[model samples]
Target: MKIEGKNVFITGAAQGLGEGISEALLERGARVCIADINTEKGEQTVKRFQEKYGQEKAIFLKVDVTKADEFESVFKDAVSRFGQIDIMMNNAGIMDESRWELMISLNVMTLVRGTNLAIEHMDKLKGGKGGLIVNTASVAGFGPGFWFPVYGGTKHAVIGFTTSWAVRTHDTNIIKLFILYQFQCSKHQTLIEMQYKFCTGI
Candidate 1:
């Protein structure tokens, strides 16, 4: 596995897509730290992962993605354990509430916070050389489907932010910048292994 020894951090990782990714990466021999708002589900997810991937390979942290302080602490915790966050998956997002507030936080602010939080720790990960961010940009971001306007808008924000993040990486005195898009939900091991190979070219 390309990321076999690398450290990984994932947000919204208590269940669903986040859980899948964490399991996949851990199975490949990457140490992972899961950040989730749902502490109960997060612990449960960790239990399930350890059952299969082994206890030493994975961990979890309580993180409210909307809060920058919590996001900052996750970086510290991940770094303390693995000395870096070589790969970070910003996969937390939602569309549950009413339009205005939901769209504002879910679509725009969440992605923005994830990006900012990752950037805050990128220097330590690569010895100031920059790193990889696999930001999830939905197919919805590229198209506006009926009844999905708000979700689509936030997805578009993710896309735009991804591009901007790449272009600006150099400004921080870092190089070898990388950002990728995930359009759909595929199985965990398959997609994670593929991504590790493609990103690291191993």
Candidate 2:
């Protein structure tokens, strides 16, 4: 898509893939909202982006993806700042099995809620311009891993939700759904089975 002049809201923009993606989009002339729970890192990221790009090109909001109100606020604030949102990236996630519920809320529930909010703001039927929604998943969503099964399950739910929405919104050009799967060796068990075993005391 032509990103120039478009506005994007990304969850988990404090670090990792979300941060990288936000940087790339900003570099391509897109305004971005850096939304993440880490206030310091999120502000740092937005400051860096604004300095590197321009003051109007980036903003940061402290958002906890697991909280519906906070997550919804990101969208509202982004629209208020940028006039409209062209893209919504539901990219926040976690890999801690010890806290499986938090992981699920972070990975799956956030994406679901973000998607709903994105559609509400970007739907043509709702008197807004059309937009794109991208959900970040992991390779584990489509395959198996001996370690981090719960994390994998959360990603799987993401894939399912995105696909179901894809089908439901098939004929509509108002919004598009995409599932972005990142493949990193560190996330896969094959590259760290021994380390996993050592860490888990297995």
Candidate 3:
């Protein structure tokens, strides 16, 4: 499906892969909200996109994904700015395996909260248009990480939640669900799955 004219809200969009996705989407004519805890980097991302894609194409929000209120506010702000949200990318994550609690909090709990908020805002039965919710999962989600059990578990939870939720809500016809697995495997594997399930209108 075409991404043109879509309004995308991406968490952890200040740098790294999130930033790259934002740039790609903007190039495809989608307006993006770059949300992250790093205000400096987030603003810089917005500035870079604005310079390349025009000032109206991007906005930045200082968001702490661990906070439900802040997470929800990003959605509200994006809607207020762009009229509606067409895509929600729950992409914020951390890799510190030593602090298991911190890892679970950021990787697992925060995603659960974000998914809840996204459903509330995007559910067609709730007086809103449907949208696509693309979650970021990793290869570790599907296999064991002998080196980092805690980190692996979080990603495993992500895949579990995303798949189960997708099946549970399958008949709703209100939102399209997708789990974009990070290509940590060989380059050949990357060509095998795009996992881009376009959100058909509700």
TM-score per model over all chains: 0.80, 0.87, 0.87
For every model shown, the clashing-pair count is: 0, 0, 0
Query: Model 2 Cα displacement at 187 (Å)?
Result: 10
lDDT of 3 at 63: 84
Q: Model 2 over residues 92-190: C-alpha lDDT tens digits?
A: 888888999998888888889998898888777778778788887777888875788898888788888888898776444545544344455343432
Worst 10 residues of 1 by lDDT: 173-182
How does residue 34 of candidate 2 score in lDDT?
A: 87
Please, what's the RMSD in Å of model 2?
7.7
- Please write out the lDDT profile of model 1 over residues 101-199, one tens digit for every residue: 755675578767767766777765545434556776666777774676777777777878777777768665433322333444455644564456444
Measured on C-alpha atoms, candidate 1 has an lDDT of 0.70
Q: At residue 134, what lDDT does model 2 achieve? A: 82
Model 2: CA > 4 A from native: 175-183, 186-202
Clashing residue pairs, candidate 2? none
Return the clash pairs for model 3, or none: none
- The order by descending TM-score is 2, 3, 1
